[model samples]
Target: MSFFVRLSLVLALLLAGGCASLSQQQRDQAQGIAVAARSTEVNCDRADRCALDSPLRALGGQAMAESTAQAPRHYATILDEGELSLVARLNLIRSATRSVDLQTYIFDTDDSARMVIDELLAAAARGVKVRVLIDQLSAISDVHMLSALSGAHANFELRVYNPTFGKAKLNYLDYAGSVLCCFRRFNQRMHNKLLVIDDVLGVVGGRNYQDDYYDWDREYNFRDRDVIVAGPEVREMAANFQAFWVARRSVPAERLNDVGKALLRGGVPALPEASFLHPERIEWVDEEAADPDFINQAFVATALPVQSVSYVADLPRKHRRERAEEPLAGQHLTEPRLDALIASAQSEVLLQTPYLVLSKPAQKLFKNLRKRDQPPRVVVSTNSLAATDNPIVYALSYKYKRRNLRELGFNIYEYKPFPLDAPIDYRQLLPPALDGLPPVPERNRMIGGSAAGSNVRGSGSGRKPSVNGSEVERDVLRTETRPSFLGTRAVNRPLPVTRKGARMGLHAKSMVVDRRIAVIGTHNFDPRSENYNTEGAVIIDDPRFAEALAQSILRDVHPDNSWVVAPRQKPPVLSGLNYSIGKASEALPVLDFWPWRYATDYEFKPGPDCPQPLRRQDPGFHACYSAVGDFPEVDVGPKWLLVRMLTAFGAGLVPIL
Candidate 1:
């Protein structure tokens, strides 16, 4: 029988019998697992000295002061310019001397993930206490190997949040079983992505430890963003990590499987170089020559002069509170605090998220914002139908609810993927379809970034220069008309990277408050992030850093990068009908754009296609997906129809997915 047939059989047994019966040997294997219900309390951040001044203080030349005394002043350095973001993360790992605490939603079994994890293991071996807390949903592949890595060193510990029964690390079947068996808890995942080393530095944003997050994927790359926070506020970040580390919701990796105990047997080395898959991954970056100088510069560059900084977090058990257990009126709630932060915005607000399923309460908050006489200028940037990694979310939020959002003064911009610039190298890394991409203009990416009031195109390269006797015009066009009453502008920005990749997905979750205060974290301003997952962010209230961040975001709204979404004409009848149908059927909801989902041609893809380097794909092994494959999740047999049926009838699930 085929694998699908076997999967269906196994699922039938699982649903009917609750679980399959284990053989004597299987039972023996499981008996060795540390299945004890209680966990020992431990301080993961005992060595945290983030509150003190570091020997290496960043921005010594820059002049700035904080607006608040209670908050520590720091700077935010955005890694959105180019491939510098990739090294910035790795550099943080290498710079750690005392401890490294990493928590994320997903850490896939990809080249990027391998390199980062290997670095962590190396750090642990160097007596740097390393603690890794990952959402169980993302630990599907390489679980056994990860468990071994965790047990290999006494200083390293791996804990998974809300795991399921059976071969969780190897199969996606356990997700369905988990959702079916424990619907409520299973949906409430830990969505926060955070990394802090030695209690002083924290990197938070939408990135998970995967190849796509780092723009290294062969087929697609995420045009994602992350921010670095250093200084005293990192202590609070560490405290929040400690709380989650000991929470009842988090389970030790060894408790989930027997392989954790056999780690000492040491069959395969967990180092990235030893892997058959990514043995050559470490060589991607020319380390020996460039690394020493780069690391030194990055150590100071990553740290910013802060006016003020604060950390915000949702309790690990945010979704578990019962109706009666809810805090009384006027009580400060952790999950609701993000809303409070938004409410504090005075003149302007720039919101960026990936998935956007608004809850009833959130809708009401927007309603309140609309009622203000001088409402803050609200601009929201999220994934468009073509750019979204999760099409189901697009069906629900964009397909069904977008018009309503437009009516509420939301200047919505669907994030456009960075075009595959064909002027760069990576001859062996990417597929043949991707060629002639632009190179990262390292000279243009100056240390302090673009100055305020300079022309948007000022890279010191002067005027729009031509390459190879042709203008490097991008393919994106502005679809929005000027001066609508709704104050709603739709803009799509081009990906700034010059990497050899087919497409880009917007995975950055961030906000800019009044153009001075910035926040970066993993919370998607949607129902899933608001009510179903634990999320966090670090707030940097500094003018210089915020200006740098704003400069990057403003470029995304530039006409050269994205296709603006505005009503040149009334939306089509079919579009409206499909949206209504989608609302009625959230799961597998189809949009009018459904038929065009597979439109992967460079000429027609969502973002601007750079004109001169007109590198058309081979049209086979599509570089983009139109709601079919499950990457970083599952690959086969799990039908979308099942979700469709559930969405049509199961109203309770609307708040979950």
Candidate 2:
């Protein structure tokens, strides 16, 4: 081992030795507090949990009662907008009558997170069973917050999975020690995002409990997707939650190293009072959630009646050896099921994900599809260098451009950081009745103003440039909380102020095959998802649902919203020699120094001759489009340089990222 590895192991051992345990008296006192919290019920007269009246929740209960074994009917709704997604979650959570179980990868301390924590605590106080499971590295790192939760309520409980030093929080040194002592276990994470209520309804997708995921972040936001389902399949979701709840690595908060130590030293305390930075916005949402008309229009009217829907999830440990020991084990559920769906595609496959790094099996499957006599059209929507939060992963995608374009036949569209037609409601960022910001324009509409003589109506660089400014004070994650836990001091780095406002990155993981099948879940369709993280998805075989999903993804790829990636035009002199050199350099595992690339970004020219987007190989493509540099709107600086360096040397990090 190297000197650094040896030092890390020694420090890790010291950390293990420092872990504190509770004494018998302390343990008894903690249990007594839990019992008291559980017994002080506020809604003693109600048979059901004291759930708020909500039409959306009523539909979920109705669906479960009406479902049958022969034909399992489900009410499904596509959540394509960030504000609506948050509202849907809030409504469903408030409507839950029996229990609420949540599992996620990230639960930060922000406005959105505080809102959720408040709701869950209130639910627990009203005699509803509440449980939350978060991965250790990215869970709450505040010792005070963890302690408050540990003694908050008897019905409320929290668990951390695979803690490195048996602690709910990690310091910088602990993070380094974990990587050195146990790299494999450190890299494995529980990436599943799910919320089930009363064993009757569930919401699953890529949105996590963070301000950015809900478009409440001032500097950045995510254009994410999720689906709310109500039917017999929710029972399966409940069972999956139970499995993870009892998984070997899932450790309760009160039993953790730091939390246990704190509880022993300090007696049980009441849950801290919430002080939201934007109480007006929260109150507005709460009022709207209770409005019957708004609930009907936003959620109930959008629901689709589907007959065939099933949920697939990976086992908790997510390893082949671990699977062999369990009676419920079999082949991994998520990736193979997706592969089967893509292989069965007859015409086209519309896929949207933040990352595009393919696993070996995935690459092989696509290569085989390309070799077929008549291959399906694969259209992928992903992030550009300017839009992606992880530039290292983007570098790997940049490195494999030639192979992905020629061998796999992928027509890729990179999302713009400040797309013209982004589907975000800017009103949520301000107080209840603020009129300073520009109103949200109709999506996918073009305005006439740009140098190209056309612009997206609500484009980032438009009249609403200051929409990024929030009057409310922000509750940001502390800088010293936990650095490099997920391979970086901050999991998401702020984008270059190139556009001067809020930037959006694609976080929706979905696929539509042949306009007949739809999938929405946490799978990124990347190597890390396939190999390390546990993933899950809800598959619907209804044509109507597929068409809705297809339209949503199609809007993201509109010319006004994204840039098309196509091969650069070949030079007339020594074209063959240049091509040969490029190919040879791309084959190298490192030191790929060739400057010219096989593909570059292309912008569509709106005119009489080109009414629609043409295929990359179309003979008239050059007339309808013009080449923009490989990285547009990206400042020429460290991040830009890092992309080049990683593209040349970062191939090894693909599988783990």
The candidate that wins on TM-score is 2
For model 2, where is the 10-residue window of minimal lDDT?
Answer: 448-457
lDDT of 1 by residue, 206-324 (tens): 77776656645544556667767666677788898998899887866655543443432333234334452444445644262135555445445444566777788876657556468
**Count of backbone collisions in candidate 2:** 0
Error of 1 at 73 (Å): 4.5
Model 1 weakest lDDT span, ten residues long: 476-485
Candidates' C-alpha lDDT: 0.54, 0.77
Q: How close to the true structure is residue 158 of candidate 2, measured as C-alpha lDDT?
A: 91
lDDT of 2 by residue, 1-657 (tens): 999999778776745643444665665665455445443556545767768788888888889778777877799888776766777778878888889999998898777788889888888888889999998877687767887787787788898888777777766656666665666777677889999988888999998898888777756678788988988899999999899999988887777767767666675556667777667668866776677777777777778888689999987757435544573366478988999999998889999998889888999989988988999999999988888776667888998888889889999999988776666755554443543644446432322212111111233433333443444245344211134545436644534645565677888999999989999999999988888788999999988888888877877887877899999888988888887888898888899879998999999997899998888889999899999888888887876777888888888888887
Candidate 1, residue 634: CA error in Å? 22
Model 1: residue 327 alpha-carbon error in angstroms: 6.2
Which stretches in model 2 have alpha-carbon errors above 4 Å?
A: 1-39, 319-331, 429-488, 491-494
RMSD per prediction, one decimal?
11.4, 4.8
Candidate 2 residue-wise lDDT at 415: 93
As a whole number from 0 to 100, the lDDT of residue 446 in candidate 1 is: 31
